[model samples]
Target: MPKSRSRHGAKPEVSPGRATLAAACASLVGIGLARFAYAPLLPAIIGAHWFAPSAAAYLGAANLVGYLAGALLTRPMASRLPAPALLRGFMLLASIAFFACSVPVSLVWFFVWRLLSGIAGGGLMVLAAPTVLPWIPQSRRGVASGVIFAGIGIGIAASGTIVPLLLQQNLALAWDGLGLLALVLTAVAWRGWPARSAPAPTLAARAKIPAHSPLPTTRLRALYVQYALNAAGLVPHMLFLVDYVARGLGQGLDSGAQYWVLFGLGAIIGPVLTGHLADRTGFGPALRLAFFIQAGAVILPALGTGTAGLILSSLVMGAFTPGIVPLVLGRVHELLAHHPSAQKQAWSTATTAFALLQAGGAYGLTYLLTATGGDYRLLFVIGACAFALGLGIDLVVGVSLSRRRFA
Candidate 1:
């Protein structure tokens, strides 16, 4: 591990735990509330006639597009903005975006706000690492990062549980309630995110690539494809799992919502469990495990959304949804470590590549789902195929990539 020291002379007042907590809250807003909240809101969003059912996917796509843009700009933005300022600013923007959804805005306006909210979510994901990582002691970084990232699951659990209940009262109130909740959380963490005076960390800058570093282009590209496949595979479940339970299984919407809640509960502990599994079995084995489990989870619902099958599927799928990324990134680091230089660039490149895949996949699948007259079952099947291919890639290319050396 690199020597732990504060950059740009950060103050001692803010404990590392506080900073990690702030990152967790930011993750809640940036991703949990801003992005994933939409899934629960989907049926209501369509029911209220905010947009046509056919256009629901496009609204979701807009957020992913903005997320890609924000990720691309993350490195540059971190350098320019203080970690706290950026965190607060983007968080406030995200909160406003949530509030804006409650109003009867035109479809175009809703799309615009969704895009803005996506940007906030992306910024939070990119910034949270640099903001929290450097502040913590070396020995605790792993655990702290896990806690911070768990904010996504926390937010998901909150949304799945709360949003359904809120929808019973009024859909607009649900949006308003979420926005208010974000504001309250932001206020609590406001002091902890590092200020302008503190050291503002940069992801690409921290690892510092050597000029003569060899490009492990093949391994890197393979990693990218694998990451993309993993993401593309999960979209159907992430976006429409609740609806699937209700419509596909002939269960009611409330039953579908309950499954979403179960998924969120699984998500909350997934990162910790995933990290432990990777430690014992290795990231490769872990990736393979996650892929297979996720595949089965997606496919089970399709084969038969029986009560037991749905519950089991929900647990496994939810656990691995947020759980897979850390393992993938860990694999990326292991591959780049041997190179000695360009590791940081490789990290940035690999994540950027994955983000693009997510964005592109969102757009493509939205179009596909709409074109097929909202054939969600077909989408899940396609997702399962994607997961199957990812498993194959890991068994073949992933194993080889781990063994090969770059000169």
Candidate 2:
């Protein structure tokens, strides 16, 4: 970390915990509220006659498209503007988007706002942790990151628990309530961003840094594919799990939201648990295990939507949803442990791949749902198959690498 000082040339004290909390708030708005909230809200939108079921589903996909655009553009945008300013701006944008959604103006209007929120979320997701982690000590960074990322799960849990109560009044009130919650979070995080500029490095200090090594291109490419596949596998649950439970099972909105609540709870603990497992077993084994477990969870709904089955599926899938992020990143760092630059580049590539497939899968599944008259089971089955393929890639890579090591 670079030395930071005030304008008077005196060292400024920085609190890593406060900074991490601020970043977590940003993520809560970006992904937790912006993206995950839409799933539970989907059924309600359809029920209120705001849009046809198909249009509402497409609206959900619009956020994914914007996320891709935002993620791709954030690095370049940061080069021109300060990260703190950008983070603040994105949070504000997301809050505004939520307020704008309160009125169902038209499909195009709703889509544009949803897309903007997605952009805000994507930018925040990319920038938040990177901004805060540099200030944290190496030993505490893992726990700090888990707390920051847990904001997503927190948001999910909040929406599930809060949206229903808000909807008791009207759909507009529900939207307004969400916007107010986001605005409050944005206010809390307003001053949390650390100072951007660090003191310049001396020439001698710069010379001590080693050159980046060549990347493990083959393994990286495989990782990217598996990461992309994982996104495809997650789309069904992320977009339709609430709807599947509420309408598909004829259980009503309240019951479906209950399941989402469970998913959120799983998400809350997933990162901490998965990170611990990786520490003991290594990132490779942890990731392989994640794929296998997520595959079973995704496929469970297809085999049977019994109450116990749905409950188990929801918890497991929810846990793995955000839980898989750390595992993939740990794998990336492990693969490029010697090359910090390459690690950043590879992680960016993996994120892009995930976003691309996420958007594509959302649209494809929406179409499939329409064609099959809303066959929720088929979507779950397809999602499971995607995870299965990702598992296969990992197995193949593991075997091939083992052979190379032995040879």
Candidate 3:
């Protein structure tokens, strides 16, 4: 029997399976290798006199700014170029730019390279849903997005394990090696990715949504606010968690590193599990659960005085926080349907907002920490409040959406 028609009276068709999976995996590789590898390696790089403390922070901020620009540009670029070609180009640029970190250049040059890498990484993220979403059955989008995001966990784990060991022997060599690895992975991805036609119907159909569709506009705005707030809450932990463990809790470098590794481990598992749960329960409830878990996790350290408390807090926060990105994006996919143009707009807008929010979070933490005399406890308090606020907002949005459906 023929498949039932969609709301628009078009026969539903399943997208090709292998090709879609390959593309999604490639996107994961690109994001994992490019965006995440830096954090794991930053300590070693800073210790080696490669970047002064202020310079390193500036470079990180620059990367965030570049990401915002890239997210804003992704849709316009996709409109003109083939998605595959654009993906290949962005991957290559990011790979090369990251490898440039090994050259021991001036700090100015380092910031430039990092900024370019950030831009490329942003493009890859914004492009991922549009490039891969069409190939996924609507019913399976949550799982597919989870699977794709799981690559981030793998990438984080790989960097944590490999970079530290390499930097132990030689920092420059490790940076160079990481770059080479990214290049090879990009090549592998390019080879495996399927060819796509220009001006595809999926793309065109997505672009046709009326400007007044409450679904896309409201959902996109909600996601942006949620993500931004979440990112703000997370930045303190991402940047200062190690310092808190090492200085605040009196842990050694190795112990701090292990803590990060545990965090990465949780990150690896968080998305897949959250995605599965979202599929069964709905994104709204899943996100609320995640935020509450994160809120509790961040506050644990503040409540405790010993190593056990800190370690437990680290693991819990790590597990819940990073996974939120995929969950939020997956929800966008669910709300917008599988249309290409709408996907592009939704992703681009959300990502851009996310990037800006990340930047704001970083800067906000910086100022707050400096004002508080480098006291992270106060930051944790702020983060906990922010997470609770985000959870409340998400619940409200979910309830509002449900009421609209019945009305």
Q: How many residue pairs clash in each candidate?
A: 0, 0, 1
Better of 1 and 3 by lDDT: 1
lDDT of each: 0.75, 0.86, 0.70
Better by lDDT, candidate 2 or 1? 2
Better of 1 and 3 by TM-score: 1
Off by over 4 Å in 1: 1-13, 137-139, 195-216, 338-345, 398-407
> Which one is best on TM-score?
2
**What digit string (tens of lDDT, one per residue) describes model 3 on residues 106-150?**
988887887787788788778865566555556776776776666
- Cα deviation of 340, candidate 3, in Å: 6.8
Model 3 bad stretches (over 4 Å): 1-30, 197-216, 247-250, 338-341, 398-407
| TM-score of every model versus the real structure | 0.87, 0.92, 0.85
lDDT (Cα, tens digit) per residue for candidate 1, span 45-78: 7777778876876887788888878777776886
Q: Whose lDDT is greatest here?
A: 2
